[model samples]
Target: MADFTGASTGGVSTIVTDHAALISACAAGEKQALKTLMKAEGGRMLGVARRMLRRSDLAEDAVQDALVLVWRRAHQFDASRGSAKGWLYTILRNRCLTMLRQEDREVATEADQIEATSQEAVLTAAFDGLETTTGLRQCLERLDGATRQAILSSYVLGHSHGEIAGRLDAPLGTIKARVRRGLLKLRECLS
Candidate 1:
């Protein structure tokens, strides 16, 4: 264990060294090596998984399964072929992609549908409850339909900017700008 703390310093060489040492130790059946690797990169790995899988539970499962594979296949890593960090992310990404493909085939159960409907109802109600005469409502009404829809789809409907962009058939950057400017306008109006 060569000071895992050095790995967090954001230097490329230090990260490579730490990951290489950890992976080598893992290949040698050192259980602590896997723990150290997880401690060092688990958050980033989970972030990547979450971005790919969307669902937190599924992202967690993907990260766990990727770690298991890393333990089993550590011996296959070749520093000459690529950096240790890249190798590790490659394994994690592969696991996430596999899980995503499997998820595509999964059908929503009745309970899942009910839960989603209730959640949507709650979100919709929050938006609907805004009194017509309130400053917020009046400010929202002042926005153009596209901008207003972008803001509501994100804040009220719980959609990702990317999802809203796709739904509106607009560029992602445009959708983001609409939301940002829309909020700024609302803030100015309320003030």
Candidate 2:
């Protein structure tokens, strides 16, 4: 395997040439090609994953997963589309994004549970005609109809932005703004 350490010092062309050859060698199943490629690019790939995940362990796992994906999918790489380096980074990015989205779902689930519990308490108080509930109802009533509906759909019905947008026949951005503004107004009113 050729050493690519000096390629960066040599020039952009040298780096590109080396990366293309390394990718081709890996695709051809050259025994040491994948190992050589990792040696050349692993640290940079890990850095990219670390920045995306913000956790050392998760970043390491993502990089390891991305490497396995690269090895398995080497044959699918098309040099005609772009540089080999870009292709490798694309794989790493996809892995990182997948992990980030999965983490978001887990966090959202926990948050939703907490929100549900709080909402139940609020509803119970409102039904009991508590003074706080009267104040909250007045605040909610002061919001414009569209904004109020958007807020209710999100907090009460647990509808996602897209779902609320679809139900309201409004743009997703519009729904998001309405919900945000509605919450701010409610905060101001309660304060």
**Candidate 2 Cα misplacement greater than 4 A, ranges:** 1-17, 104-191
Identify the leading candidate in terms of lDDT: 1
Model 1 TM-score is 0.51
For candidate 2, report its TM-score. 0.49
Where is the poorest 10-residue window by lDDT in model 2?
Answer: 121-130
Error of 2 at 86 (Å): 0.8
lDDT of 1 by residue, 63-158 (tens): 899999999999999989999999998898888766654564344233234455464454456557799889988898898877876776554433
Native-referenced Cα lDDT, model 1 = 0.75
Writing each residue's lDDT as its tens digit, candidate 2 over 17-77 gives 3667777787788847777778888887776675546567878998899888888888998
